[model samples]
Target: MPSLWHSIPALLLLPASISAVTLDCKHIRVDKQSFDLSALGGPKTVHQLQYLQPSISNTTFTIDICQSLKRTKGVPKSDECAGGTRVCGIERIYNQADDSSTTERVIPIAGEFSTSHGRAMDPEVTRLKDSASNSDSELEGLRVELHGGKWPETSGGSLQKAIIEFQCARDVTGNEGFEDAAEGSMLDIKSYGNLTRRAGEDAQEDDDNDDDEDGPPELPDLDKGKSLQFVSYKPDSDGVGVLRLNWKTKYACEGAYDEPPSGGGSNKTAHWGFFTWFLIVTFMLAATYIIFGSWLNYNRYGARGWDLVPHGDAIRDIPYVVKEWTGGVVDKLKGSGGSRGGYSAV
Candidate 1:
């Protein structure tokens, strides 16, 4: 009974350690369905063309973050984030619903920015402290790049078009789901302040360029949270950082192959099949002629083995013709052998 009494205090302390933290934030969505390589009206297949099903990995999310004029400790400041209330840090909070719980430190703003096309213009979705992504899973980087967004020491976008690559196993492989690298495939992103407008006429269409020398372009970063302009940064008003991601996926819908058979190979096979038969017939005809000639010689002329068919009459007549030309009828009557012994009296 005394030991059971000691456990009462320990059970009561559990609730105090794990407190429920409700995050006051907004969600900015960067949808993927809008940016499709095929819909852009160009040569769709490139970079070896390995597509995936229209599932989770096919899409990416981005959010622009802005910092307020009021300085938040550890949050960096930038020219684009000047004079307004903006987002300071991006914190990924975890609650007690899964196997484990973790609250990652807020991703600090780097003050770097890149310009890209935008579509949505929901003020309610943008002006909050929280953000949503294309994926709920945590991914390290882009599959095509084998890595994710980078925080370089400059502010600009790569002029080269980015590629969105799909990741799926071979047809023979049993694994069908994209959940393995799903975490590393997702984009945990932040960007400049909220978007003020939807995609406009000035928005540039996705560039279409498959380099003749180099390979295809890379997929744009989903978490490339570009800083935004702000009127002022106060207690509530913060600068915005916009996230823009470009992902291209390649996948088969139903019956397809990695390397479809080409006409060149097919054409070669067709021609080769015909010529092989032609050669066989030619060889057979030649053999038949030689065999028949030997048979005729053996049966009609009693020729020995390996002897050519008789055509000796033509050779014997040649000398007769020559003798007749030189000695007239006297030599011609005895054929080519006439008077050959000793200039015979005849």
Candidate 2:
């Protein structure tokens, strides 16, 4: 005879399945990370990364990806980062030197990257192959269309699931200290080439033209409250591959952000500022009335000025009383006052 609440946990533990299509994507954090490199004799280039914050429309990320390449087989290094693709999008990368020096740059956003291979002047990566050896490589930009919602507008966004596809590739080096150790390194790369849906409208839509349903829905805007699932990953074993990433970038504005405590950092006495000013003004006004009233009565009413005023009778006799008291003191001091018998200075 357990209550309904007691059965809730049991039901939740029961094996359940969902048919919703979930997108898988490599979770590229919004921070600086180790830059990716290509095979041996790869161009000496710099790569950039950046993300479009919900508040910003454009951003810039500058980096100096520095690695010293050595001459192999008595051959001078010819091209730097010559045969590789540098993926830059929707993020920023920071390369900070130990001297407290930092380089910042913005990466490309959605649909903005160079798939072309081995051009000397790739916008994403700067090539200084011909420059002096040990010269720092500067990554100027990885420009692309930014996707994100605005603050306050995108706040409390709804959670959504997206099928993201990404390819993870890293440079693997065998010789720890060869002439071109970093470049000659070979690592088995994973690629996510095939994208599968739940066989719904997203999978059936073939025409990229004006159709009710396009291929897969665009990525959800990057938000703190949104959910992203990388649908799959494919690795490339031999040839170099592009590390493409799709994220949840179109979140519905429905989830609630952790609002600061309703009355946090607020002082209960904040209104005291106004209250203090009010008291000062009231006191000043009262003082003013008192001072001005005395002046007016003296000037306008002459001898009868204080006659009608509060406690005016006692105040009016102040001069006469002071004079009488003064004379009495003088007479007593002289030992001539009435009923004073002692005249000797004892």
Candidate 3:
């Protein structure tokens, strides 16, 4: 017989519910505040965002939040993201001698889609607090981190990560408006690269250790005017490459937190309390015991009427027993005493 541990992998291979993905923006709760971004995930559509880098390999990062991205038309499904992918990064490498690009690398940064052979980590969601906001009591922004993306062993051992921040910008309409308003700060992406080299000596050394030309990039802090842009992509010492992006939208504003739907109250999910569950279980157990016992009595001894019920005598006497006990208590309270201080009869 195979060892029990050997079967563990088979057990893990069992079909798992698709909802295991880390973040579900539809019912997100942070610090007692709830948010619903289900609207952003259009029907059979994903909210797509793209970032381009022309210098090092015509690299493009196409991403979607809250929904999987669809493959491009005329492109083989294998060339793009697999089904259920939320973040996909493509790098087209051009030949140095000829201006034509001959090679392409597909990097699945983050996604919920998985296969029997492998599964990606569910997206991680966190809160980003903005001290400047007046609603300091609630979260001012949201941070979503995706994991389970790994570079080939030949490329590097680091797992790819994507961290997207949604900041509150009440004046902005949505991602589209934010993207348009962010054109001025596009140059910051290159400045951040220089900053990365100066940030730490180890990062420079690590870059040389790996042949990947497009080493992990980094993002600068949110600029004064930019509403949407790349943040950073720095590989950690522990072999994790993180790509960060920021998007400002009114939907992330404080007013958006747990706002009731128009023309209706919030539909809070009702749950039974501990006592309620306990009573239900107790009743079920009692009913089961009584039904089983009655069936046994009927079949085994031909019992009828009250005799068919187990402990029927004790149950029938319960009312009388309570009455007698109540009467005794009342008599005791009245006191078996004679007139004045005379002794009471035994």
Candidate 4:
């Protein structure tokens, strides 16, 4: 009979069934266009938005496009969702009688939260039709779908999902904390219906809200915002939760990532610096002089050992020469021999 240890090797050899999910915000490619969102993902940065319904419930959505959100303090890695988590939602419901609040659930809306194998399905990228295009023939926005988040137990057992829409904004940054005129960032709430309904309505509302010819729409403030902002969260008939967000950044504009060519004959130029050229020239000159001198010493004088090297005597006496020079400098600094008396030297 085989021992249990013998069976462990076979299990170890088995291939993993899970697939890896890649979230490269710096290089999000959609058709002919590419987006770089490295600006939003700063060191120790988490873009968060809060929603509160007075005396009922409050919710907060936290997201990071380039990396996993920082792990919660004092919480074990296993207990809190950290690795492979791009977007998370935490909802707290308040008691009607005493105004006491309890956390309803913490949902990892977008990302793979597996402790063992770090893998997930590819995020779905699609072209979105919005007011920016104005015509149905041209789609002006981008949509990214990320799912496979660990579902809360309250739901039968379905993975959490999130959809992010990239809309063009004139401003580079949307954070009110960073910008003076900017009001707020996001709006997180329950979805009244489908995503299309909200997007279509909001576009028309923006036009109506535009007070000045050159100024932005007069929209209400939510909180200090980022390029990515929460829109709504709705569960399907099967109780699977889906969250939506709107991203407004210059990167969403057409041809934002149309980079110039990087090959030869381009207008761009690259040249060695003065210091680099100096080092190269000095090294070549020294090498050539040594080679020529060494050959001359070998062929003309039949030199051997250290004699074959150019300036071999000086090179070999470097240590002794330096020692004598250092002693002389020290003696000079010491002022002729210690002092005949303590006050003899000034």
* CA lDDT for candidate 3: 0.58
Which is the winner by lDDT between candidate 1 and candidate 2? 1
TM-score of each: 0.16, 0.15, 0.49, 0.49
Weakest 10 consecutive residues, lDDT, candidate 4?
A: 184-193
- Report model 3's TM-score to 2 decimal places: 0.49
Candidate 1 error regions (>4 Å): 1-266, 309-346
Instruction: Please list the residue runs of candidate 2 whose C-alpha ends up more than 4 Å from where it truly belongs after superposition.
Output: 3-5, 9-346
Compared with the true structure, what per-residue lDDT tens digits does model 1 show for residues 1-346?
A: 2343354365445444323111111111222111111111211111111111110112212122222224434645542222221222222322212312222322222221222222112122121112245551232112211111222223552111122222222232211222233422222322110110111111212223332453222323332321111121112122233232232222211111223333333323334445866886676565455556656776787776335434546646889888777787665676765556667664
Please, what is the whole-model Cα lDDT of each candidate in the order they appear?
A: 0.28, 0.27, 0.58, 0.57
Ranking by lDDT: 3, 4, 1, 2
Ranking by TM-score: 3, 4, 1, 2
Candidate 4 colliding pairs: 21-120, 185-225
Query: Which digits, one per residue and each the tens of the lDDT, describe model 4 over residues 1-346?
Result: 1243344344334323212336666556777666655555632222332323223344667766666777766755544465667777766554433435565667777776555334463588766753344552264667778876756543455667877777766565434243433222222223212222343455557568773554222223334455555567888786768887777766666665543332534322112233554775676576566667766887999887778778899999999999999999998989767767657545
lDDT-best of 1 and 4: 4
Writing each residue's lDDT as its tens digit, candidate 3 over 1-346 gives 1243354354344334423646766666776666666545531211212123322244456666677777566777656666766776666543323334422667677675456216576665656773445464265777777876765524545577788777777667444533443332223334534443443344455566774664444433433454456555668787677777777766666557445545787633212233555775676576566767877887999887778778999999999999999999888877754354776568
Error of 4 at 329 (Å): 28
